[model samples]
Target: MTPADPARRRLLLAGACLAAWPLAASAARAPQRVRDSRALMGTRLDVAAQGPDAEALQRAIDAAFARMTALSALMSHYAPASQVSAIGLAAGLQPVEVAPELMQVLHMARDVARRTDGAFDPTVGALGLWHFDAPQSSIPTASEIRRRISSVDWRHLVLDERRQTAYLTERGMRLDLGGIAKLSILQSGLDTLQAHGVGTALVNGGGDVVACSQRGDAPWRVGIRDPRAPQRLLATLEVRSGFVASSGDYERFFVQDGRRWHHVLDPRTGRPTEGVRGITLVADSLEAVNGLGTAGMVLGARAGRELLRRGEGVEALIASADGGLWMTDRLRARLVPVAG
Candidate 1:
């Protein structure tokens, strides 16, 4: 149940937390784009839209934020009152009935864990020994890690479709939806926008963005960070629809003895993963790229690339631990490399 969004390592510039972008110009007859931001799940959530009705678009944005807020309350691992916490609290006891949305995300997490061979597990809730947050950032001892790692299995989490419940078979097991819930919530935000008939809009949270463009409008532009150069952007990605999700060591991390420890843990080892500095994925749907970004981080470069290559339209941008950059063939076409 770690707090999300460190305001670091994200490709897009978020509110008051990322590198600054230049002011934009508006043409005399240009249509107005309404943009608003709110801090949700510890990250800056932004919504930008351009349409005929500015007031209606604003209302749509409000509804989107409201949907995200409600979903996070149900699924946030950090929230003690959340259904996720309740399921963990009932581990080894009995199944806990959960909301439909929580059930859907749980199913999604299980699917990702299955596909990634446990690399993208949501059941790493017990591996919370490392505190990356300041004032108490401490790494766990080997013994502690071993003890916690024993309970970090995604297989033990069972969901009952008929009963609408979630159960962890093992005692002391925990659930941390920090990985996938954000995207689902944000997807819900986009759904809210569409429900309100706002077609062209972008929803950005943390470093992840989901957006669409009108037929006559220019595509939404997002800046992607260069892991090798923290202060610099590697490239800009234009989006018409779909999503851009990223995972990096810089997100929630600390250094000890020159070694960096991050929140993205290897479920098997119950420690921070290695051999990849960051991973960014762009695809047509959340289902296409849900846990793959972090999975690539855990899988490293070659295997990560192979994994991504398997998917039809999943474009990847991987910054390896050695500082080398690798990307999918198709992704190169979507990028405009940033000039120094």
Candidate 2:
């Protein structure tokens, strides 16, 4: 009467342990990370996140990409319904009301143009007559370029901040925010990740990347690609809560008769700048470094270095056409050069 049967006790103990197994597993499961990329706005927007629940992580990543897509629709010049297109259509006719976000971006573009003395003008969209994506890319004729150059002045892009309206004072005047819009979209993706409560994450909009928090104990590593050799890496950077953006002549160009014609144009001449082959900028805030990458190439190595120094926490690395290299001392410390 006092002793229990051994086989029965063993069976009961096994059942109790089985019931507790699921609870133990739930408590012990560590957060898993997910990484994904979506092609949007002619470039890939990449997202990576870590969360205790896999489904939550996936949802956060999707939300981040959705944010990027929505911003692209608002700012893209290709989208017929985009605010940028609306502004272009109203050129010389009247002021077009735009969303506050578009107004902010337009203001930033104008600021960059003034800072670089029109080197990074958004009104260079007047030269949008040249198409690199055509069936056969070709350079514009001198006469055609001259005709359009008359409308390429940034001063013509009048932004009324109080009204949140933009006006292109010339009939053929156009606006393109290809420079800073992408970076701003990347930042928006990061904000989405944070809104979803995803702490450790990375949002890489093609060449521009913003990393938040740390991956485990180490910071995220980003590769700076060689402008001449897209397949090779020029340097690697380790960062936590930092933004890295690059601009390169190789990004969009066609070679003709041993001459390279790229898309990053100089507003004054209606031609691409030939000073630097590529420029990469690292900064604490994405907005702070927005448009500076291309501005660096147009600003040249000397002015480029000076432009970066003016910022609170900004550094740059520039590769010149003459096979020369220039980098800020702070960036040099954080950069690990790739070996030949």
Candidate 3:
């Protein structure tokens, strides 16, 4: 999907109860919040904040954009000279040390990869054949896929916490943080805002949203887009605190020969996942939810449900390719089911 599509937009909701400020009054005095959205990290970032704090908010937004740009440069497999690209060059041969931030993200990516059994792998960078952003991207051959698949190994990624470095054991191995870095950046932005004493803000980075504040009256309202009908709303979540993130194949895919090729590549087979079309997750932390959504999608309906059941403070909604929908009990509590 193109960036203009609403389905590609990530929405964050934050709500808080402030004893000093009433909800209606704060809503009235709501800082003059402005939004600036641009293509960053291969996705859109929507930032909004209120009060005379506009200047601080703008600074915070600029800081976030800058950080995300750096992250994209470090993690993008498309860039031939990026840190990730360097790792690819040394894959299966030597270990490449990475920056501290990159190392942290890589550690999280590796954990998700292991916990999800490679479903949410950062090593899918081996599948360099398909281009989701291209106008006419085509699928690669089975043999080509297999050859590259051999290089997709998350286990080869070695992290030294004491040294704060990341190493790729295989010669052609690469790291693609597309699954989690954006959320990390968003969380960083939120932390920045909070540090600046900006209690109210929303960071919506391409459908991975984190909202929080010790102020505000009612819960933050977040809209979930209907996967089958992008123009319509599926349900509205009232988030008093915490975050909500969603991943859907429909956001980035191409239709060729009646087959759909999405961006969420499976590390095991180096191909876009089938079965589940989309997955939405609600949790208190981005670190927890970052790779979980992709893992849930790759696990299909049953396994996805099982994963959610085992996770605490996490709720999920899954949409299948066959048009069937499933929701965890926690998610059901938050959503008002639409009549069939």
Candidate 4:
């Protein structure tokens, strides 16, 4: 035998002992494919899983979806009775006690805001002056924007670690977790799946994606949509175990006088961010990827590259406003270009 074979084999065996089960044994048990889909977090949630028992996997999927639904109730921006809504309703009056899960999200949102230096601020909710939705598509007068924009500041959101509460310092301040919460909610669903003994799975909410383990002989395949082309994919990724989060200016925007007014607004200006049009971040953990895409869009391609370099395991594909495409070296090597 080779000198390192025994040690390598021992290490692999140890890994199996620590894990839930060995991948080979899982496949040996004759795993079946299970999939389900539904609307979640204001987008479609598509989940596919693999396990030995179809019935067990299906039940696990349902539980996972249920967990996502529960988490969504905590973060929804439009839900009047949501916990976040309560925080906004009590702004300047009192700190609202929130669930631990919500507290975790708030902590994450604030952390991202701090790290990005307001490039992707959740407080941009205060600039809720533009409506990209049909029948209500409109923008506010410059005077109105200037007034509300003053209240848009992430530092204004206070999280009380001792009391597990959230408070907004300004009377009309709002907290929109749209940039950060969907991935967490999807992650909650994936956690539920693993807790239920299903390990090989993929869950995608609109564009944010997370997948684990292996599917037969190959890893999970995900298509990265082109920001410039709605019908074409720029590339496809083969993920082993990772989180994917994407942000785009084209998703909800209106063109006026040759200017694109998108929902992803810059907190500093109360207007859509300029320079980068879209960003897709892939990382080993949700924490590494969440909010990064939006931050990259605001920071532009160069600064965004600097931001990605700060993270240990993050890779990205950035489509700039000037129609130039940039991809991290690691991703570029593995990224398969879609044939035209």
Write the residue-wise lDDT of candidate 2 on 1-340 in tens digits. 1135341121101100100000112324454757686788676666767667779989988888887888899999989999899999999999999988788889889898887777788887788877765466878888999998998888888989888899999899888889888888888888999999877777776578777773442356677777656666677777677788888887667888998888788777887888788888888886678888878877777788788788778888788888888888998898777688
Per-model tally of clashing residue pairs: 0, 0, 11, 0
Q: Give the residue spans of candidate 4 off by over 4 A.
A: 1-30, 214-217, 255-259
For model 4, residues 1-340, the per-residue Cα lDDT tens digits are 2335342122101100101111333234555767687877766777777777899999999999999998898888779899999998898999999999999999999999999998888877777778977778798999999999988889999999999999999899988899999889888888899898887887877678887875453466677877766456677777778787878876677787887788888788887788887888889898899888888888888999899889878998888888898888998998777688
Better of 1 and 4 by lDDT: 1
- Tens-digit lDDT track for model 3 on 228-247? 56555687776656778888
lDDT winner between candidates 2 and 4: 4
Model 1 residue runs over 4 Å out of place are 1-12, 15-30
Off by over 4 Å in 2: 1-29, 214-217
Decide which is better by lDDT, 1 or 2.
Answer: 1
Q: Could you tell me every candidate's TM-score relative to the true structure?
A: 0.91, 0.87, 0.87, 0.89
As a whole number from 0 to 100, the lDDT of residue 162 in candidate 2 is 83
Worst 10 residues of 3 by lDDT: 15-24
* Reference-based TM-score, model 1: 0.91
Residue pairs clashing, model 4: none
- What stretches of model 3 exceed 4 Å from their correct place? 1-30, 336-340
Q: Candidates sorted by TM-score, descending order? A: 1, 4, 2, 3
CA shift at 21, candidate 3, in angstroms? 16
